[model samples]
Target chain A: MEFKNVTVVKKANIYFDGKVVSYTVKFEDGTTKTLGCMQVGDYTFNTGAAEVMEFLSGELSVELPNQKEPLIIHSQATFEVPANSSFTLHVKSIADYCCSYAK
Target chain B: MEFKNVTVVKKANIYFDGKVVSYTVKFEDGTTKTLGCMQVGDYTFNTGAAEVMEFLSGELSVELPNQKEPLIIHSQATFEVPANSSFTLHVKSIADYCCSYAK
Candidate 1:
């Protein structure tokens, strides 16, 4: 199902010198999400709250701090990251993702 | 430069049975843009006005009606499509693009 009621945020954010770009969206229930794209590179991200990431396109290799092996996530797949922890993403290609945060 | 003022649209449009998905953004200048991702497939799109397409990541092979050869667009590249015409996009890999329409 598509999100027909969420409002797209007004501003865009560029991360890691433009290697990653994302826009924000606000839902009716006062929750927010971010839709972003990552370039072909390795980058580290720190999160304050838990995140559920949904892959829109391309492939992504994700490595959590506690995981031994990197998880290969493809299109239409979902992954989870814990709060107060950091994760590394090794992007093989242009990858699009939607990140939903906990309230 | 990033667009910090444009607002993301509330509704999401899914095309070709979810092969392509896009979200709208409204600028302060009264123009609108669409940020979308395309899966691995070849699809056709018809436009009502002139469009400027910018590649965010990955690669795309585009074929216009008047052009005999397909144009390969990579990251940080841009292409134009005429108004009231249809163009075909051959997506070899997952690609991310931003499309702006002429007012």
Candidate 2:
């Protein structure tokens, strides 16, 4: 199966100064998922299994707990829904739930 | 091709209580990434392409800029290296680099 990005996640590598930066990835969506932090050195992230469009920007914002930070990854999200599987993703946002996903 | 998850990114959801929380993901790795602000209601994130077995924990930690928190996502990262493509993901970490990746 091929992939079409549902959204894009762009990550930037800031200079030692912390204020300056370099950008990688392009964009991402709600279902898209990633691991680790998105900073200098060797950052990491990945795509979720759902498509998010109906949701607003604020809705897509994933706020970590306490003092954890959110990763800003670049590049669109793409995943080939597995073949003959029962698991599927549900599409919605933190603000307003708007879609249903199933296989 | 199938995925093997170079790393895993796990996220959690907090109750209205705030201080308390609920864990969803099992584990993550260095290449994994996330988006938005992982909190109540809905959240989003993605996976970074890279294997970090060669790195350490502190290396897997993802720190965002300003006050942006990082999403604690669960699950593994799996991407099928296209059958024939020049662009391939390099595996590494933000700490103690130890590997080279390419197709």
TM-score of chain B of each: 0.92, 0.16
Model 1 vs. true fold: TM: 0.58
lDDT of 2 by residue, B19-83 (tens): 11222211124222222111213211222433222221111323322225532322222222222
Tens-digit lDDT track of model 2 for A7-95: 22223233332211222222233333321111112212232333231221111223222325542322223223222332222212222
DockQ of each model vs. true complex:
0.09, 0.03
Report the Cα lDDT for residue A48, model 1. Answer: 97
The 10-residue segment with the lowest total lDDT in model 1 chain B: B1-10
Off by over 4 Å in 1: A1-32, A36-48, A51-103
lDDT of 1 by residue, A1-103 (tens): 3454456643345677555767777777888788877767899999999999887776778998678999888766788899999999998867778899998
In model 1, which residue pairs have backbone atoms overlapping below 3 Å?
A: none
Q: Report the number of the highest-lDDT candidate.
A: 1
lDDT of 1 by residue, B12-89 (tens): 456765557677877778888888776668999999999998877656789987899999877557889999999999
Which ranges in model 2 have alpha carbons more than 4 Å from their true place?
A1-31, A38-103, B5-103
Instruction: Give the candidate number with the greatest DockQ.
Output: 1
